[model samples]
Target chain A: MDDLNLLRDLGRALDREPPATLVRQRSRLAQARPRRRRPGPLVIAAAALATAALVLVPALLRQSGKAPATHRPGTVKAVNLLLVGADGVRGDARADSIVLVHLPADRRRVTVVSLPRDVEAPAACPGATTGGRLSGTIPNRSLTCVTRNVEALTHVRVDHVAILAYAGLVEMVDAVGGVEVMLPRAVDDPASGLKLSAGRHLVRGRPALAYARARHGLGDGSDLDRVKRQQALMAALAKAAREKITNPVTLARLVNAVTSGMVADRALTPAFLKELATSLERTDPATARYKIAPVVPDPRDPARLVLDEKRAEALFRTLR
Target chain B: MTAPPAVPETASDADLIRRSHDDPEAFAALFDRYAPMLYRYVARRLGPDPAEDLVGDTFLAAFGRRDRYDLDRADARPWLFGIVTKLVARHHRDEAARYRALRRTPAGAVHDDPADAVAAAVTAAAVRPRLAGALEALPRRDRDVLLLVAWADLNYAETAEALGIPVGTVRSRLNRARRKVRAALGDTDPTREEA
Candidate 1:
């Protein structure tokens, strides 16, 4: 056949089987939504209120975390940050979720640590990990373990920690429309209703949040299982942010939503967030690698586990 | 005076870029118009299915980055061809795979008479594989300029406009791309070389 005929035939076949089949809502239609046409004064006041909320919320949350000594004099070199999330609403207690961030000394590599919830370790705080002092909450235990382990292993200092809640995660997901994920195994949990087939899926705001939190529904039913899920979801989120939504206006809206009710270490600022966005924009999804912290079965107790310090340290060192 | 038959609504490359920036559905119109021509060029060098996907993706990406449009240029062929050139290079294996797939299928009867069929097939057999390999091996810039002119039928000025390069650059690149293709095809005749 001639080249034109060959192309026509192939186009027909491809038309029969398109790569993407999802129904996407039109962007212009969304933009065309009704407006109240507020007066200039009211519009200005609303803008001011939104700006104040963005600045105050994160600042207030940062103050709640343990204030590490700011600005340790060193070659302004690569920094590793441990961002922890706690379940508790109060300010006095420790964090629950832990993400060990390793910024390469050359600023080329960024590795993250996701500590499992049930891994037993010596309580770092007077009663944080064991919840012996503060009602022994799960979030408290997780926070204590992360802080102690981070300080013990790597010479790289924990630059700052940000404690984000389920609400914060949901709002962020909603702001980004939804996040896409790949599940190696099926999830059939009644509680979360996270019935996913073994393949790719587009998890929307609420479902995506549930997927990150659902521990009991996955294979081998443990917090360890959930940690892996969280890392995969984070990678997928990064990919979607890079490929599907790279516009500044979309990013600013996302920042507004995520930073709306967030708590952070006083050290992380809006300037830092802007810088992070710029770095993130240049990066392609194919280059990023996400792995959970390695763990070994506890020698003392069969039911418990601990961080493989030697292996974990090696992993963190590479991040440097 | 009776109005002449209405010509179909067609936008210049600059107009298409502006429309693409404002409306994606309007941009899809450009894809539908040019994808066939683009696909045919690719299919001749590669095969069919790979060409289709590559052509679609080229238009999709071009549409997505419509804001980067150089509105001064009236034709988008060079930019579109540039994307196709990159994609084809990246998926060289896929093109080979397509050839293998084509080989397995029965060769359909050529449109000419029995005598011409044999001659045409004989010519195609000698020309097709060498052409494919040589086309694939050309430097990306030269290949882009050559195919945009030879297959997409772009003039030197239009090719330069599409590629965001000077007309002299287009002429030089086309010369280089043709010389390489000719060398691969084993055409040592002085007349063919001059052409």
Candidate 2:
């Protein structure tokens, strides 16, 4: 053999990894890039004020088709709430966690489907999937955009959105008195401040916050792992919170935490939240299924993600 | 006269880097073109874990410094590879340990160098494992130059460009690298003593 044969052996060894990985990394880099900050305190304040007004209202007003369709009982038919967890709101914001908590007409099951952030814009051009080439608008209005994308992607209209910054998540976890989470592996990411060794961890408060917010220090360090972690934490939080919602003290604590740091659309009222909570309280937490929106590489743009139409439709139907 | 249909303009890497100054999105095309090959190259040297972070950082670094990129160089391959080479250099211990581990460890999982199973040809099997050993034995710089040529398939001039060394230095380094590898192997390579 020649000196070159060692290289050939090494190349074949390295090349064993699937090409999907490159596509995923490219899609992630494209979709999850931090946006540049634009000076807009006035706009943020105004939006915050509007959100405050929404929070104060007893019931949200909506006409049939004009409203984002939800299935909430009492005031609405179904409740579709987008729980957005981002580091901050104003500048260069991306929702590190987006979970669409869908309460069906029956309201027996709480389906929290976590959409993979790497869902490339369908209209993205070649090479647009990596940098500021296209879709810069997606990051700033992450909750708004992702909810809309989820609606389009799943044929499930998202009616309410709650943007919970890290502070709110900490409070919420504490309010429910934390949750028990079994690690798929030992997570030790110092980036997002998560450093738990793998085991059944009774995560709460700051550690719980770290667990949910951690985007690194896990398997493959893909956003997919974070998505899975977020889903698992959400389910655990829900299960824990379900037992305590009947207690006035705990409920009041949750309200305080949620109102302070949680930004929401005007439609999500305290009454609606109570009603939604009551509905989900009876259901088995095990029944709360989570899904990352099924995706396929765009035939036209290889790096970009598009809805896996058939499987996605099936998933939505099954969840619905 | 009727205008002929306009063909879409395909931007070269240097052209894209130049254009990216105005339109940052133009850089993704370069990433799509090279990141996989870059990942594989790094993965072979370091392993998968570091390769993921290093490869991502390499692109970000390339994008960060895109404006300062040498426009005279049309291809981004050498430039991208050079950035990753610097990153791999930072993990001197892990990189050294990797070569040592490959020497002592049995194959699979951590150090799965694909044995030349199909390419036995009733000939080159004996030669390749020795080459792996010789690779382990060489000094870091010579190993880098040899691997940059042999592994990355860069031309001698491109290897010189990637490593920021003179063309003559690349020649001497590669020759020195291969001589040591061949010497370590002794009579395994039929053309062994030519060096």
Candidate 3:
């Protein structure tokens, strides 16, 4: 027999099941690892302080999504947050990126489901079936529309929503001294103003904005590919966020970036952000799952997106 | 919408390690994915009883050092097998004894060795008994390179990566090891490159 064939038989030599089982080791390990640590008194106090800081600046808290959120202490359950980055920070701008973060009851896993903005999600829209692309921006109450449509699709109750403009993306990236992203290939897309050589890049400000928005130049130019790149960038951002939490200057800058640029629900105050940052700091950056909401082309118009039922349900089941 | 509905892309093994870093419990999934294969590899060297505990320990060790994991390489098989190989080395007496038993036994069956299963299939495989002996006789590094490629089915590059040696070293060690094995079996292939 040739060397390769001999090796194949040799591999099969050890293929039989061992008399003992290693399956129980998983539970054994589960017991060893502690359950999620609850937010302690100091953490609570710090969160409260942070919340007070954000609340102190009432001018930043523009009531955009819905009526102000009535403050309440949260139980140890999953918190769903809707974070949208729009193209134009100040005016009525389309959503460039929409991500929903699901922090499990254990707060161990952070599942991020990114809604593709390029698709026409008509079913998500109240009346117009052709305009799901305008998901986070419709009429005066864009976040409500985005929240309502997301609820209809995933059955996930969004507890908090943060709408960030393009500038916010730049500020957040810069706040952490810039985020590093691994590019599979060099991107040179003038459409999204993304022009970088293929390699790891420390993106900040304008480049970061381009990195998030340069869907036109990267990865077959599909919205789905863009969703993946954004997820990687977000994971890097999350890693950076965890690292910066200990440094007061970066932490303050992060808080400032959120307060000044983001129009979030009243529930997403500085206290909430502090609690979240602390909770997520313990999380493994890799355990965070990124999913693009499943979509199929509309039969009548190819540009529109109709939620793919079976797959969409499967994606929601994990969060539910 | 012209796009496919949801293509649930499977997360790479490296990605799993990255996710497990923040959440210690996330390591369970990685254990579930790899423990069985690791157990087999361990069992082949040492018997099943020790294999069980070592497999568990390997995962625990892996979990402890997950933060140092390189996210660039998606397939973590080489890294994992490398860990298993080192753990197997600690049982040198057991491995040497198994090879001695195989050398003496007519059909090359060592207790719980899983060699008989392969021996039964290969025609006139009188050479396996000697092969086991030759493997046991080899230098640890040379044996590691050979078995990783021959038994573990890792390619040259993968073997190098797993062993933290250069590909040239992997080739040279494999050649030297193969020559010794061929000598033990008394199989003459003078034309084959032994470099």
Candidate 4:
């Protein structure tokens, strides 16, 4: 037999049919596609805060027909905005990251809490059973289901909901010329194609997204480590936003990028965002606290996590 | 306005890809069509364990770059193959190990199918080890060109498009690879009639 034909025969010998259908892959693809129909909220409440700090001031002033004025403390109420980084098409999307942004009644501090996606939580939605990973609730139920669960767990009301797709996250990061991330050790994660040496690096949109998404080949290979990275990325984004606010051109680009990237609840109107932004202006990036909800491995499934009741209550009480 | 006609089953890959730009769900049709063949091709190189994930990754990567696709090209096979090829390169070690393992496997060990005629099976079994050893010895690029043609059945033009190389380069690489394979098989020029 000719060598080419022999090679063909060898290929046939090695051929195998995949064990199962491509359902998992199909769903993954579905999740990766950016949702186009819904215009939701931005990824980082910090992005909104920064955008509001510079971009919205003039717009708000024009609407109110008032001279330049600062937002006084005690005028605005404490707000809890649920920022969800989700994947998949609308309605069936999965919440990969869930962060609660709390602005105190005094607006002196901004406390952003990262809730690990694998934590077990009760389902507060009607006709839904209790006890599943918080992230799973979004796919099985609606985004409202996830919000209700968060409220039930923390005893805090969710005033606004914003979902950011990965695509939007990329755009917002690039809009501000990229965010600086500090890695203690060099990372070369093949899965996500995130290659960065140890130390500080200013990563553009795609690499920033990869850094946030990569879990393996990093610390402990746990989901909590990824949560920490996400928090760090958000803080860096806020810092970048603060730095870029001085440049009107970059500020305009950021406003356009941030607004287009997110899908927000109707309640989170332009006026409301402006108010939130103005209130956050006094907040210092150094004083902004990032916390992960207290968690312990679930007794039933060690791989999953259950909130440590006492510590979680303490954490939630602080947010309240 | 009247509702647009449903996408026909016979819709070209480029048509589906264009539709997916507007409706992301439309990309699933492309997945359903090409995934099986793509899976088999990857499985042939990397074994079954990584095949499923790799194929899935290929489709996901393709979906992300769907807008950049040359809509003028009616067939997405070459494009899909190109994505899979790059992914396979990332796992080059696994592929080389697979080939080395095949070289060690005994003749007729894999071709034990009852449907195969005894004589043809013997011929295939004899050549399998030598072919695998030759493949393992070839440089990664030349092997890529050779396998895309011999295994994937992509013609010279399609192979060039898939690899992002010129047609002449594809010809030269394939020729060099075939010469090595023939030498590895001892140049017996066995008079077995071409299938």
User: lDDT of each structure?
Assistant: 0.54, 0.63, 0.65, 0.77
> Over the stretch A92-170, how does candidate 2's per-residue lDDT look in tens digits?
4445666666666665565777777667643332322224111233344435555655566677777777666656667
Summarize candidate 4's per-residue lDDT along B15-124 as a digit string, tens digits: 99999878776788888788889988999999888898898899999998998999999999999999999999999999999988889888656554655435446567
Stretches of candidate 4 off by over 4 Å are: A1-35, A39-73, A88-91, A124-131, A137-142, B1-195
Cα DockQ of the candidate 1 complex: 0.01
Interface RMSD of 4: 6.5
Pairwise TM-score winner, candidates 1 and 4 = 4
DockQ of all models, two decimals each:
0.01, 0.12, 0.12, 0.33
| A188-277 per-residue lDDT for model 1 (tens digits) | 654453668878888786678668767655756676777777777666655554443345565566555555434555455555543332
lDDT (Cα, tens digit) per residue for candidate 4, span A1-320? 57787778777767676655445566567668765464234233334643442334434344456554475656778988888887633555667899998878766677889999888877644443334778752553246888887998889888887776666778778988999998889987655657789999999998898789888677887899999999898888877776666677876777667666666666766667666766655556556789999999989899889899899999999877
Better model by TM-score: candidate 3 vs candidate 4: 4
Candidate 2 local lDDT, B1-195, one digit each (tens) = 012122224768888778767655566667767887898888778877778768778888877777788899988788888888888889877776777765654444332334443433233344545655777778888988887887788999898888899999999998998778767767645643343
Give the TM-score of chain A in candidate 1. Answer: 0.64
- Model 2 bad stretches (over 4 Å): A1-15, A31-34, A42-320, B1-9, B105-116, B120-124, B188-195
Candidate that scores best on lDDT: 4
Q: Estimate TM-scores for all models.
A: 0.43, 0.52, 0.45, 0.60
Ranking by lDDT: 4, 3, 2, 1
